[model samples]
Target: MSTDEEKSSGSGRLLTGVAWAILLTGLWLWGRGAADGAGGASAPTTGDVAAVGRPLGVPLPPAREPLAPVGPSRVEIPSIGVSAPVVARGLDAAGAVEPPPFATPDTVGWFGTGTRPGAAGAALLVGHVDTSTEPAVFYGLSAARPGETVRVTRTDGTVAVFTIEDVRVVGRDRFDARKVYGVHRPGRAELRLITCGGTYDGKTGSYTANVVVSAYLTDARGV
Candidate 1:
């Protein structure tokens, strides 16, 4: 069965909760870096950050076989001009998908239950819009419009192109998980990109809304 998180009442509380979780992640990244001598003369590179970095061709050992020509696992939106690698991770018992690298505790990725970009079901990708000091890769996602293309590069060297269908900015308190994760009609595969958006509440420490971009897979290979 598919599991969806319940809607909340106030974005303030949700943001606060996320901030606390993200803070822990930040501390962990710092601590791990220090222990690993991240201060080395080499200077930090993309590999240093959890989900924020340049796209590389290095293969993850013991790779999961392709589920339909999964591309490079890198995503690109030509309209906004964004291209970044996406990692996949299982959800915790709490069912909360991890935040992006910039959000702290550095747990950016999607829950594995959803389909990959070119596959059958809805595929969800989550990222942080920004943090206390830096803007994230997906910060301008709310501006994407219908007809724009969202490209996914799979591990098997194929690209899946998705045409944007719509965009919405929903309050975190009212995020609708069912609508976001619900199965799609036959012949149509959906992709959802999510990121923090709207004003940031310093006191509560979270964004007022989440920017969601919905798209339908238009082109695929090896399916």
Candidate 2:
């Protein structure tokens, strides 16, 4: 069986990238309000977010789309102990969204262009668990289990709590975009958490499988 840490092909990269970007943008947007002061309702202050060191590499594969801001703002998952600054951007060369690393967890990234985490559709969040030099910001994410709660603190000061419904390890080739990216029921919001897991392959410089977590809105306030 392939490990969860493997690098998926086109679809995997897109799926993982999009999810991470949304979560990452949420964090960034939470800290910075819009120019017109719109959507700053409950966003987090820059002081509340964690800082980080410089990025690792030049970020291979040129960025494909222009970087865009995230929705609502601020992403907080207290259960997982993840509170950090975020930066949003559009897709890059590999067609994956990129989020900047927050200071706390060595480094964390996101997908700049994708569904917002607490939106009506399947919101995605991606993060690195670890790298060669250090433990990644989301390294503890694998511990997330079904029935667990994921709270997304939006810019409006409203909080959306999602209940973990499913968690699985899938091969990159078997990734299903429609199921993962498609919209949910009307007025209902969903979220998908993704990360590389299983085993790392030095030859490919990626992982063998992907750890995917699915969550649905259980509660929300202050939209």
Candidate 3:
């Protein structure tokens, strides 16, 4: 299949790409218990949220109608102090979605081929967990709890407001692509903020798992 850069106009489409499929497949190669490493300098994951998931009594707002397709320009999550520019990123040579460049550790990269931020499907926004010497834009991503707000400013000046529905530290061995990357609801516009989590492996230069934050469009407004 051709790459997003070659096949997309940033239209609305359900999350499906050879790159993403291959990506989760690769992550699935690691051992099942990789989410809890046996020996690593990696810090233990923690969060302030106390049972805020939808099943736990957190009231969620109604989903707004999916908007016309438009590229996202920025992402802001006040609960975790994330305000970063969004860049369109394509697949690497391995046919996996590429993260933002390390040179710009504070920027979030959008999968240009998949669903737009406020469109009918789930839009993916990925960021770095850390750099060589510093915490990156998504370093605090896991700290974000369910019921928080994630605002995506689109190119058309509409802000797609989403409410956090779930947060998970997905182990590489159990990387369920449909749960981690698929649409949360059939017609609701959804968003996902992903970053490295679990434990960091100095040898592999990557994390053992991923912090996946799931949210759905609850509101929409201009500016």
Instruction: Give per-model TM-scores.
Output: 0.64, 0.60, 0.76
Q: lDDT for each of the candidates?
A: 0.53, 0.49, 0.67
- Clashes, model 1: 10
Residue 130 in candidate 3 has what lDDT?
68
Model 2 lDDT on a 0 to 1 scale: 0.49
lDDT per residue, candidate 1, 63-140, as tens digits? 122246242367888888687877875444554444444334233355444466666555677766654444567767
- Candidate 1 regions with alpha-carbon error over 4 angstroms: 1-72, 93-95, 103-108, 184-186, 221-223
Judging by lDDT against the true structure, name the best candidate. 3
lDDT of 2 at 194: 62
* Number of the top-ranking candidate, with TM-score as the measure: 3
In order, what is each prediction's RMSD in angstroms? 15.7, 15.2, 11.6
Could you tell me how far off, in angstroms, the CA of residue 11 lies in candidate 2 after the best superposition?
29
Instruction: Indicate the TM-score of model 2.
Output: 0.60
> Over all chains combined, what TM-score does candidate 3 have?
0.76
Model 2, 1-223: lDDT tens per residue?
A: 1112323443222223333443333433432332222331321123322112123442222111211223535555566777644444554454334444323443333344445656554566666765444556566666666666777665556676787655555544444344333333434466666666656555555556566666677776665
Q: Provide the global lDDT of candidate 1 against the true structure.
A: 0.53
User: Looking at candidate 2, what is the lDDT of residue 189?
Assistant: 64
